[model samples]
Target: MAPTRQMSRPEESTLDLGEFTLKYRGDALPQPELLVIGKRSGRHKAVHTFVNILDNDGNLVRQAAITPDIASFIFGSFEVRGSTEAFNIYESDLVVGKWSPRTRTNVSPDLVRHQRTIAEQSFTATGGKLAHHWPIFQKLKETGFGSIIRATLTLHQLCSSNCPFCSTILRNKRDSVSLTEAQAFVSTLYNEQAALNRNEFVRYNEEYRRLTGTDIRLKGLILSGGGQPNLWPHFSEFVRWLGELDLDVGLITNGFPPKIAEDVYERFKWVRLSITPESASPFYPDGRFDRQYIPASLRHNDSLTVGLSYVYGPWTDDDMLKRLDASAHENGFRYVRLLTDCNLTRQAQLKAHQDLADRLFRLGFIDEVGKPLSRIFHQLKYHGSQREAEELWSDGQCKLQSYNVFWDTTGHEENGYSHCYPCDSVTVLADEQGETDISVSERRFNADKWGTVKSTEVHRLFTEPLQPFFDPRDICASCLFMNNNRAVSDLVKRASYGDMNLDTSLEHLNFP
Candidate 1:
């Protein structure tokens, strides 16, 4: 039997107001950046006061109000205890900004009633799956592109591996960018000004301002490739330079020992290694399981998280999965991600993952009730197949495209200026007539091909109005970030009347 894990209760603080006494537990609910207030009218009736949003430093940023319906969504329904009409209020129930660390009370600019911002109030209203990206929703209200909080830098488009399912491998033609160019790109992103003049910054900055009138900067970067990034010549130098920026960096690569410096590799916040079926052959050949198939550097270290991704198809047998699971456990990998081959038919894709779940259950990796036991496998249950013909989304908006920037080798740099794609799925290429050509594929076309970036000056990209050329309903057959799209759309719909609604405060934990 497994030992039961214990959870520590959060410390409590109390506030007395003669008629009603409020008790707050910081950890009882989702963490809140804004304060909330709950007033009791009678024994069971609750009255809530709505007001302007305040920052932690006791400054007014924006005006916001909470209706009764909005208040209930933010604080949740109240529960009465004993005979005294005292309410055990969660931190989320208050109508103020973040509490002062010095004083446990809600930090209000003036009064407790006018504490939380409209964005804070509205963010908690819709507890959707994309709640983590509530920050993006606020920016998306203006343009599809203003909410971008992360960037994917695809440095090269070359791979020697003979993977059968690779779509980008066929397009491997561009040479890796020089180390000088890569370093310059990183520096430009870090500095915030490369091509934009003061006038351009002001013109574009309005679209990206948070509800609190603060500017949102790019928080994370993905070091990936159209092919294997490990094969890039400047991989080591670029990574070492990125370490200087101290930004949350993630790496996606085929499971090969990266020939980079150990300190540089450890700087990555996460490393998602794809251990293909071909890579698994050496581990389980002739019913022999070799633990050394996984490199020591790729295992969970004290600094960074390591995980494995496997594409399941007709080639995947029960034995192969067992070997993969065993290796993940022994290698200290966080989780094993099992995904169906997108090349397969929609029905086949669904069945492939379903069968994987069933097999794992039978093999005792998971219980009969579908709860994990020995292994944690994130089966792509919500995954939409690339072959799906029907539209997975009905909405015309693809706001997620505006929220992230995916730059690849297809994008070009000239005269200290850069023209790039919006997401990995979209690219801008010079046409036969010397005009820009936006390449559209089931995957590629889902993300819009917007404008250019001056050097790595991404400020213009965030501030510019992202006018999508195609509606997602018309072009996007399936998307991996559908939950994010749904969340952004829901938030935009709720905030249509200039009122913001979102979930618990993520404290700027924004990423793609």
Candidate 2:
């Protein structure tokens, strides 16, 4: 019989209200140069300030100092009463401007028109498979080209953790994608467009060039799966293969085996370690488990960027946050991204957490704050936080339809999984036997055993209409990605229509 694994208890702590203490360790750590605050209520004010730090050539330098006065004022102003709040600090240029929780103004009209055009064309092209293809079109339009910019390779279907909030963990099984199949897929992507006979590749590039006059190419790869990618038997070979293709690779793992830490440093661009409040205890001193994980050599490798992804919520309190921050700084992590739980019913809790997280993130009161946070920091980052039917509809349109593609080793069309919307640039899937297969369904992996890897087949499957499989309108009613996309799409539409107010007190714009 297989040995049973022990499970940790869920973290349960209230929000930390008086943990607003901020201190500078010394010149060894980077300092913030700009402060951005999004005031949801109270005075309805916005604050954006840039510290005086520039070289002779006018380039931003890292010598900026945050005096006690400046730091106090920045933190003080961020403590405002509001349902929605956002606070961000930057080490370089200030990018925070007056933002409205109810309204936003940075939308580009041309981009909106371009996105709309692609949406219409995709609807007509796929005879209505817009839902499945919206993510693809959206990504293409974002890059202004037809080349596959990024692809996610789901390496295996095995994991050790059983986090209730994880979709992949619940579906975990003892299987992995065949190394040969993985190499074949990579070869297909590495070959020149002309060398391949896929009509979709040809037509996508042709349309993109015709519209923008630039060629498309794949640039990035994500190594992720149901289980820890480093656990895969051929992880090193796969990393080497991706390096050979000249694609920037990123890894998502639970940080085990320790050896892959050094191996990934030599080839991958970045590695993100997923941590949870309950599971994080093992890596602490009392657990004596750190010796089994990443070593100091790998952590301090300057060439290899490292970061952490932590799921935050009511159960994660100030104590945990402080511990996480210290761990990141001591271990040489570039950043710690706070993620909300994936359970869709926690909308209220998620929003509340977002507000608290914004405050914590802005004050640099919790965790190390060195660079501007991702957009997900200011808004909902996953579908699990979505609520309201109208939030799923955007101007009665699906703006990002046909924007990306996803596959598993099984090559099945669906993986029996449901998300707010299809957001992956492309996914590679594996079957029960650890072999790749062609899949047809978006929410689940419905395998097409007879499907081939030809370009035409790839294009047809990727560009297929959504109506035949599911009603686009009904399926989107609860999608979390729709609202986020719509928010950005509306911004672009308004900007194009000359309806945006560009004059606001918050000066500076930079998204890291």
Candidate 3:
């Protein structure tokens, strides 16, 4: 609960890695002999386990297939003798061994490691950077009862897109939406939003309202389920309806139709178009329904404040991205944002993304032709480059924003961090089999504690009561990103460019 200041004696006790905090003595700590970091918590986590192998340098050397139970991990996994590499671990009610200590230590600056770290760094930086703009946590800390600035909103669990790059696709393991239930879920939220037994929704809304002296509006409205919401004919009606509600409207799509986008843009005006030439190779039929077609459509629509989101990574060719960035900018976007693989899944991909980011920052993070790579991390890295970057940060910890949340109709609720956001805390998920809702109880909505929040209510909060606090550039003064982004972006740039500050004020900060 204390300010996230570094512990001079961290090695003597607690070790904070910005995401997870644990007690370590530097010499020996409760190093679980085996670890199974899964996507979701509780019973939903897949049984992916690996032995805790460390070498003389305190570097993780290797991992064996000793599926040690959490019980042993909490007990003797670290204390066991005889060579952990060779020993078997008891899990699944019996002894198991995936590998032995004799296996060569997989030691190398592996690209896999690089990719994973960059992905994480990217996500955390974006979320935290944006959150720094709010007074939620600061206000809570100064309040009477524990004031937890709540970032909670329920996502409409109805999507049909089976994009390979989507974590949802990996979870649902399908190429299409589950018909029977998916449609019904949509049916429920519409006439259903105001119909829910107001008991729960009202209680929560009022509680936070009294505490913060304001209502928690839904954050951002994402019409996407797993499939494209625009794919549905009524999708326009939905976008138009939400836009009329006086909230910031956003939808992430594969850009199948520019008309759909124009329709939404006409109503919401704030739209995000995410495309992956990597997955949709050749960039046409499989890409944005034909890149030229989409761009042509955008070239004429001057009303859009578009967010160009590319499914780009380290391996993404410079030429490809250059063209991509140029095309998006030419089409009239306010800014471009890359959907980097910050989940640390691919090392090659991660570094390549960072490299592109580096190039951007070295040149003031604007492209060689003088276009703003506003979403690039070299700018973020530049943020961290200040010599006193550490001193200014509270915990000096890295994070992947808060969490990823979507909403169609689940009134107001928050699903904590996941692939798109923070690394830990309460999580809402449908089972691997796509059966039920599995989550950590008492959802932790504290953005400061989790480093991010993915909730529909969040978008609303910003545009509403706190709308007065909203400043694209000036907002930087009170933003959480200032603490982290300024240092990180500065550090990255200084490493490549030099120490300098260009007005990133909202107005000076370019928008398409």
CA-lDDT, candidates in order? 0.46, 0.39, 0.33
Worst 10 residues of 1 by lDDT: 428-437
Per-residue lDDT tens digits for candidate 3, residues 403-448, read 1222222212233322112222222211111101111111222233
Say which candidate scores most in TM-score. 1
Global Cα lDDT for candidate 2:
0.39
| Candidate 3 error regions (>4 Å) | 1-135, 142-164, 173-216, 258-261, 278-283, 286-292, 295-303, 345-350, 358-504, 507-512
Task: Please give, for residues 84-195, the per-residue lDDT of candidate 1 as tens digits.
Answer: 1011122333444222122122222121111223222221111243444454455455444454556777776655443433434324244356677667655555455323
TM-score of each: 0.59, 0.52, 0.42
Off by over 4 Å in 1: 1-130, 142-145, 187-190, 193-215, 279-298, 381-396, 411-419, 425-460, 496-510
Whole-model lDDT for model 3 versus the true structure?
A: 0.33
lDDT for position 107 in model 1: 20
User: Ten residues in a row with the worst lDDT in model 2?
Assistant: 429-438
